[model samples]
Target: MASATFRATDAEIANPERGMYVWAADDLAAWTQAQADAQFAAGYRIVYTPVRLDRYAGEALPRKQLDALNESFATARRAGLKLIPRFIYNYPGGETGYQAAQDAPLERVLGHIGQLTPVLKENADVIAYLQAGFVGAWGEWHTSSNNLTLPAARTRIRDALLAALPADRFLQLRYPPYLMAWALQAPRWRDGSGASRIGVHNDCFLASSTDVGTYSEDAATRRRERDYVAALSAVAPFGGETCNPADAVDPTPRGDCDDILREGRQFGLTYLNDTYYRKLFHTRWEAQGCLADVKRLMGYRFELKALRHSPAVAAGQSGDLTLTLRNSGWARAFNPRGVHMLLKHRFTGAVVRITVASIDPRSWLPGTTSESSARFAVPAGTLTGAYDVLLALPDGAGSLAGDVRYSVRPANADDAVRAQGWDGMLGAFRTGTTLNVL
Candidate 1:
């Protein structure tokens, strides 16, 4: 009849598929395992790599280039880091502005996507989500020398990318209107269709009144667009980076802690670019005393508030365990993951695992507390002994199911939880309580 309560930690967690992500070198091949290790050591679990295809705009990607791309995924897998990959043709600016930025024609773009589909599917384990790129300047989908910005062109590109990516994965566009134009249904994508999997990534976050044209300038239109993005973000991933304050439309000196936190919560912001406009925004947040908060609350910070379980149970009998958790982050996990309950024998090292099928971590929204219960049955052959209780939220990909680096850890205070409570080898959190099997 004993229950244990756990305290939450304010420290930042380097959980998989979320938080501030640094940019890798332009060449995916240049993303070495050493670089991944360093980033993970620096408390980063995600890396953003822009795959440049400007040279192959008129033709198919060479075998060497494709091999390099595959190598990047391998590196990520070895280092236990996920990637936010974007395939773009050109950056903004030349003799002309974005208008002169030369992206591939519609046919060529689709061809490139078709070529990249296999790589994407093969590496979906390491890919957090694919950004909708390969159009306009800097892959923001604005200007296109090939008229890829036209309504029909955009539709074709969107559909092609969605088709290319794994159905479980999401594709994030640069603007809100792109999603609104296509997804007329509700925000939640339970149907697993292409439209349901589409989300928004605002590259120009907090840069202006409308985030540098991410939303409409018209009052009525802007309201509707923001509403759509907010609703969509509840179920899909929503993230981006801060643009230069100089580019702000109002230019009233944004990036204050209050405004940043307000908008972050409003849009359910998840991952953000840690490299871009750092001095203007990140540094300011640090000085203003909200940088750590932003880092800790970006994606999904689950805290174990309490645990209830039977102190002892007979072999072959079932015992109920319940957990009270709070998602203190700005957004929930958009991708699917596995929830499990484990009983590790203290003496023999034998483990018993039960999949908690009733709970989905993705549905654990920010600023909300949820209680999930599961029943675990002891094997008839189990030895009568004390067994440690553990909880695991691991990646859904079969390839990553055993990797602790891809698992979710509760943001519980180190002092309140057992020392080394997070078992790297088992990829589970020790509940600081043991069960006796009679």
Candidate 2:
């Protein structure tokens, strides 16, 4: 029997589906794999792309545009990045040639959703989540010339987006009241039902006391909305970026580290825009010495603390392995992932994989410590040799099951752990503990 304890590392990890994301507003037809690779090389694993549908406001999306959209997904997959995609009908100065912004009517919007459903389904593996867009200016669900923000119209759009998205994915709403209002009527949202798949994204985060109308202006109502968002974020995704601080209503220390970190933890923020509102992230946070913390703590950061296992076992016998870890980030993983243990023969290169079904990474909440153990059997007729042990946390999607790009790597600081622990090819972590099979 041997046991070892490890310490946490402060270095930034380029984990998937979390951290700061670069905003890509260019047409997907022009997106290049080289651009995506550059972003990934700079330590970003996610990109926030707005799919503008203004040209097709009155008609369905053409096959050419659909293929271009699919190519964007292929680019992300090739570059090892995920996307926070939003399909929008209009931008501020779009080619609609109207004084006021205009979005399609409810019927046309529904038709567009039907046309985009298949593409969304096919590339769902690379889509981190879809934003509930397609209304008003900038697809923010406000000030629609067609009055799409009206309760009846908004409900129809929400339902259609949910139905169009893949079942395993989440749809982020622009406003908190939309989610709160729906939860009141459905009640199932309080539990982990279909409603749980809906989450919140605030583009004007920390721009005011209420995030510039993202939350209620009324104090009591705002409290309730924040509470609900906190609860929903426990099981879903909550992320966004700061708007222009100069335009803030209550401009007193809004984007400071104290305010940002407090709200980040409360909302369980998963991702943020690295390119937007540089005053806060680039200047203020940098001068205040919290930019690094914000970068490392935005999403889930799992760090292994200790491990204990049987040092030797015989063929057809069982061996015990236990690991203690802590989630040191602001949020847990919102999507489903699998935990696995692998044993590889030192000379023969034969590997045995055992799934540790007892633990789910989504339940590993921020700032909490948890332990998981597995008793695996040494298969009959196994080679008698020293085997290297490893840990893997892989995406649950069948298409991405063995891809290391979608897997999670622990933040451990030991020299051996830092140097030899990560198996980028295998998407697993070497435990530094070997088991001898007799």
Candidate 3:
């Protein structure tokens, strides 16, 4: 057995930036510095908001709206919050106000997508994920006045959106059947390249027997939906909102904390709407005093249990680097993250980074301890000195490549290792271990 070295870290329960997200709408004013700072202070790291295109269904998005969106992204970045953006042209009961001439035509909708692609790619650093919207009322991909639900139309729009996004980010479809259909059309989706990035989102989660029609009414079909979602969620990101107050089980909160927690684990939920279902989380769940726990397990919470490695290493050589990490939160990091071992000179401020591709953060499921072993090597020409070992999980691309805001915070009580930058960037976390290079 290898020698064990324990890092000085306490298991405190108030780690932020993972659990709950505040819901924000399209208004640029709402995402101001004050508002976002308030959220950050409350331990929130994400904001769920919609980019409504109801006004620009036929033409390009007005300059005013686009500018507001850019401002919102900037505000979010300043406040150290990631954004979950959904682009929609309709809302609940949108059919009543839907007009054929003014309603966006298929061609115009595709045009809008083309227009939005640049903005998305530019801000990919701060985006958590994009919901496959641009169809149906409320962007749920259902109950639409336009023929967006048609197989051809839906496929065309979906393909365009997929092609438009940056390769690192994944898109979530509202329904499972639609995903199946898209997969069938694209054969290359079978190899986990495409399928691994596509996910599911159910707006009416746990609202009724069929989750308010999120799943199939038929027992057999429902089982298939569950199985399909489970498979996709294993590798991809999945999450959504609780049911509306008008749902069938409304006014009484459908299930207790146990039921909700069990189902969340079963579904592999990565995020949920904290602004909605106020009664369920505030009253029903809070009365039982499980609200904090529910928030704790909402998304991915990784804790560094212990790390073991060779005490002495040689320059220009390889050695075993082992890490014992645990996912104490409810879900995993649903996006592509890069794991690296960073070595910084104790006195000289020299730095060397070794990428570890073997550790895929997506596979780190909740309630499971993962052992990661990598053969780390120091470069050919290095000064003989003591160096600090650090761990960095960064987006690897975009403006926030080295920005600590996109990195994961290990839930440990070690102040030095877990400290963030003055601007709230995680930069890179220390490993509490040092190696001598000779």
Best by lDDT: 1
Please give the range of 10 consecutive residues that has the lowest summed lDDT in model 2: 185-194
Candidate 3, 214-282: lDDT as tens digits: 777787988888777766766667788886535443233465777677778877777777777666544
lDDT of 2 by residue, 1-438 (tens): 757677678988889899999975555556788898998889899899988888899887899988999999999988888999988776675434433777898899999988899999899988998988888888888888788989999999888888887777899989888887777632332264667888889887877778877878788998888888887888678898877645445554377778778888888899999877877554688888888888899889999888888999898998887888999999988777988877888999988776777778887889899887778677888889998888899987778877888999898764664333778778888877788889
| Top-TM-score candidate index | 1
After superposition, which runs of candidate 2 have C-alpha atoms over 4 Å from their true positions?
93-99, 185-192, 245-253, 312-319, 377-382, 417-420
Task: Count clashes in each candidate, considering only residues at least 3 apart in sequence or on different chains.
Answer: 0, 0, 3
Write down the TM-score of every candidate. Answer: 0.94, 0.92, 0.85
Look at candidate 2 and tell me the lDDT of residue 336: 73
- Model 2, position 170, has a per-residue lDDT of 90
Displacement of the residue 175 alpha carbon in candidate 3, Å: 2.0
lDDT of 1 by residue, 50-144 (tens): 89898999898999888989988998898889999999888764424776788988999998999999999999989998999898888889877
